[model samples]
Target chain A: MENESFYDFGGPEPEPARPSIGRLSTVVANPTATGVEAVIEECAALSRSLDGILALIVATSDGMLIHSTWSEVEGMRAAAISAAALGLGQRIASDFGQGEFHDSVVSTGDRVIGIYAVGDRHVLGVVAAAEDVTLGLLHLSARRTAQAIGRVLSDS
Target chain B: MSEIDVINFKLVVTGPFAAGKTTFIGAVSEIPVVTTETGTSEGREVKDHTTVSMDFGKVSVADESQLIELYLFGTPGQSRFDFMWDILSKGMLGYVLLVDATRPETWTDAAAIKAKFDELGDVPLVVGVNRGTESDVDKVVAALRLDEAVPVLACEATDKESVKQVLITLLINVVEQLEATVKGSI
Candidate 1:
């Protein structure tokens, strides 16, 4: 049951936010034998594709932020909370037999973001312009990134 | 009393703002309803991630032999939360669309709710024509194009007896549907 908030998905746009230093454990911009490095590159590229930046946060199954695109203003706190919620949601659904939790999307006109499950240990989060992107695109891009990122998330 | 098995079912109570979803849930729930106001939400003018999510309530029906655990989630009517509804409605059995009798246009939300529920499957609905004030009940019934069989009733969300009656009506309808399905399976 989906409700479309009668509001439009646009407002004063956010300044183009680039990943900054935070508790986010930045992975090798170029990955090695494991594909984790490649996934980080994809996360950066995915942000570039939507004319927005991405935040890739790895977390312990227990809801602690492991790594992120490391923003300057907003940090891993949001991702940590999101990962916790996603884990809870997945547990609730799986107890009832819903699909492998794909992702959670949170949007309001100014910006829209997604949280995805990469294997079992981490969530891949991305934010894009509300008007510029669609859920379909975000899901596809996030999954591709998760595929590579999930394999090597805990390696480092 | 027939042997009543314990079942976990999901149900949704939706309507326009101030239509009394929270009140209705409170009235029927056996436990004190717990809620949190978050900054993040959908369809509102404010789109901050910090805003809260929607409202929810739970009721346990333990009548001697029958123990049914029902989770009644109250969806935020504002447009932004619209995206969450699809995921919320999945696997739910019925919808209780609380309509404000005074706001005729609010029926539009009911239609939107019905269309979305239909996508999941044929869901039994209980359209509660919530009277904001003393109202001509007939007008509320006429505005809602309810099938001859669908249940439509007048009630006050804050009134305990009235709310329970509405729930009982729905429970009976669901049991009836299940009985039919069980018969067919035989």
Candidate 2:
């Protein structure tokens, strides 16, 4: 079921630069094992609290996965790359001390998620299955997950 | 149009919190922009600021012999949030410091910023004083530390022609600097 979510979208959504959007739709309803316990618990809570799949991952700035949920397919190494891109974003933010970059979302092919800087060296990434999850909800959840990841990452 | 000659240089668009940096780039940008815009929190929540990181925009302009590309990265203008300037200023050709014309005191801050740009060592700078009104021109020019030589133009942040003027001045100054460098080298 990881790549078969073609017809489930809300009509015809525009494509995105990243293929993960459509890929997520296919695997969203897949049987996930709940990768990281604490994060998975938070994800479960938030997912039930809101409306979405809730893909979350914590990883090193260099793209090494530190922790993740069952939502990931490519797993650890892929998380690392996501962290690296988040790092690039942090570097950009650090370039101006514009303040530490928090989160970003790419909504395409019926996928809406925010990737954020969580800890000293880790990034917290999340995805929303339902396209209707408002920005307010997204930011709220992203902020909560970021704080959670910060605590989890600091210990590691 | 030779695909090999494309030089996409980056330009940072920066200003104070409500200074229209977002709208400025939006007005002139040729493509559908990608923005990381968050919502407003009135009194209960604090202002997280527009640019926690840099906002990027790309423009492609074509001519007979060449296609000049410009990439604009808008920086957050909070002075307290300047820890990133040291790295952001690296290899930059010039900067456009958008000053709010009504606030003359912001000129001292502008001087401080020019000093910051000067640290980049001979990088050119052009001042864009957002002058929505015609009467606000003189104070703005005087405040930006523009003598007779520098380019200090009044601009509406939402106007494309005004931005073009600021850009043209920077280009001319850069050309002059290159000429001077070649002459000194020779």
DockQ of 1: 0.03
Instruction: Report how far residue A14 has shifted in candidate 2, in Å.
Output: 21
What TM-score does model 1 achieve against the real structure?
A: 0.51
DockQ of candidate 2? 0.03
lDDT for model 2: 0.56
Best lDDT among the predictions, by candidate number: 1
Residue-pair clashes per prediction, in order, are 27, 7
Measured against the true chain A, the candidates' chain A TM-scores are 0.64, 0.65
lDDT of 1 by residue, B1-186 (tens): 346655545566777655677778878776444333455444344233221344445666667765766656666565455654654454456778788776677677766766666675566778788874435355655566667687878888988788877776776787677678779999
Q: State the C-alpha lDDT per candidate.
A: 0.58, 0.56
Ten-residue stretch with the least lDDT total in model 1 chain B: B43-52
| Candidate 1 wrongly placed segments (more than 4 Å) | A1-156, B1-4, B32-52, B132-136
